[model samples]
Target: MNTFKTEIVKTKEQSKTLAIIVVVLFIIANLYIFLIEKENQNVYLKSISFVIYFLGLFFLFGQSFIKPKPIGFFEIADTSINLRLDESQDTLLFIELDNIILKYTGYGSWWTHSIYGNKNYLLIACKNGENYNLEILLRNRSMKNDFKAFLNTEALQEKFQLKKTKNTTCEF
Candidate 1:
């Protein structure tokens, strides 16, 4: 059995900058709607602006205050892999070795990189209709390499067959 600790990256300076921009937009939108548009009676425009600005403010608060925390444990045993990602749940994932159908470095597009930093990630998909699209963050490059190597080892290969192609459909 092999055990490893997972790391979670904190929001970067870009998030702070985005948050500031959102705040400024929120204030300007509110001032315009309440001061000038009050007589215009643009009900739809006012409601839409309020919803958009409120969502922006929520995003800003989450990015500025909520800190990311690493998972408690990441275990790779002979038959199963275990992960404790959610603090509220006792065990976030307990997947059988044979259940995993795909593993790849996912979300490499420019847009994904712009939002989630330019870091490598592991995407795991299970057979029981589970798609774990979120990146599995590791400590460093070396550890990530080790984990990748382990996944390609004869022991794991004998346990499950990997799919040759990945789904590339982009849903809007």
Candidate 2:
């Protein structure tokens, strides 16, 4: 038997903070355009932007109210690998470690804007039509080692059905 526990990645406080930040950014940008540029834009454009912004904001805020559920869960015998995201499920895509390409490089200028400053991400690339990339932000050396071990494990291979493929090319 396999037992798995699903955890909510973000808390209510985190969700609220995210929503606030997004709203603040939108307001700041609009204010900049209205005050600095003084460009009289169309009402339709303003309305559309506001609608999109609020819609996204609502989605973020709404997350806090809802109970967190596992997007997918994988089990091997008694062990469970609860995937926080839907794409991690084996049903969605049968990912093969051989098909995945790992890349390690210094953080670029754009990366500085990210929450993890100059951190490493274990980039897992797929070989199929779906060009999905899993970026796991490395926190410590132990975590990195554990992640690598998990990826190389037979249980993960069986769970994900990792296969060896000669073709590394992925078609969009």
Best by TM-score: 1
Model 2, 1-172: lDDT tens per residue?
4332222122123467776777776776456445644367666766766675666666645443343232333322223333345554542233432344433322213323222212222233345544434333332334334445555555455433232233312111
- Name the runs in model 1 displaced over 4 angstroms: 8-68, 71-73, 88-118, 158-172
Residue-wise C-alpha lDDT for candidate 1, range 95-147, written one tens digit per residue? 43333443433322343322232233344555455554333444334555665
Q: Give residue 53's error in model 1 in angstroms.
A: 27
lDDT of each: 0.49, 0.40
Clashing pairs in 2: none
